[model samples]
Target: MYTLLSGLYKYMFQKDEYCILILGLDNAGKTTFLEQSKTRFHKNYKGMSLSKITTTVGLNIGTVDVGKARLMFWDLGGQEELQSLWDKYYAECHGVIYVIDSTDEERLSESKRAFEKMVTSEALDGVPILVLANKQDVETCLSIPDIKTAFSDCTSKIGRRDCLTQACSALTG
Candidate 1:
């Protein structure tokens, strides 16, 4: 009877879960964004120091509960080799957060290529995306307008899915 009651209680209070994927090129601050998000959302969560965080060779998983919904974040490694594995999780993710290093102008093209590929993937069709132009704290960083212009080619591939480009400083967030 106790076990039955416990199960019933859990079922009554279970939160809806949504899986979100964090993707970007290496050194684009994906991990920092994840750490900052966890710290901000989970009152008691003690995320690693931003300076001490290293490249994620595999992935980092974090869960945040807001109201009656639970968000599961998958922070994947962004090295060129690791990018090939991104599609493996596409089918399971409900949303995608693509980070871009605003200070790195040279890599903007490469980032655009990657973004286009991601948006065109059939596995992720119609998945909402949030493109973050990171490093906005830097005086020389690219503005949101610049990032948008650079990625304009991808607009058609993005289809009817919800998408937004916003500037952010993960270190300060």
Candidate 2:
């Protein structure tokens, strides 16, 4: 009875290993989004009241399962020092999810640079990228067309496919 209950509980919630890579520039809500998406709200965290999360480390893996698919969320290291390691797992991923803090105008250049690096890399050359123009709920979030244009142009710079990027709250299943 205990084993069955535990299994049911995990499945009912979110946990899995589909290997989804979340890439973006630093402080792009990459970590906080992962935290909130996986678990519920907590009162102890500093930004819990303001609705934000602290910085993330070099690398982290967050899991969320939908249906029978296990989503192994890979939160890559956003720092200049750690980004060199991104190639190690890029090939291992089935898909890519690029998160952009549309509200952060200052980081746009970094975002473009990072994205160019991704599409030009050997590992992610053909993998379909899902860009989350996140923080759209915010007043300054970039328009979907603008974000898509940025992404499309980056892919063009890297000579990769310019598939229409979609605005996703979360990629389910």
TM-score per candidate: 0.96, 0.73
lDDT of 1 by residue, 1-173 (tens): 99999999999999999999999999999999999999999898888978899999989999989999999999999988999999999999999999999999999999898888889999999899999999999999999999998998888899999999989999998
Q: How far is candidate 1 from the true structure (C-alpha RMSD, Å)?
A: 1.3
Best TM-score among the predictions, by candidate number: 1
lDDT score, candidate 2: 0.71
Clashing pairs in 2: 15-65, 16-70, 17-70, 18-70
State each model's CA lDDT, in order.
Answer: 0.94, 0.71
Candidate 2 wrong stretches, greater than 4 Å? 1-16, 40-52, 157-164, 168-173
Report the poorest 10 consecutive residues by lDDT, candidate 2: 41-50
Residue 12 lDDT, candidate 2, scale 0-100: 86
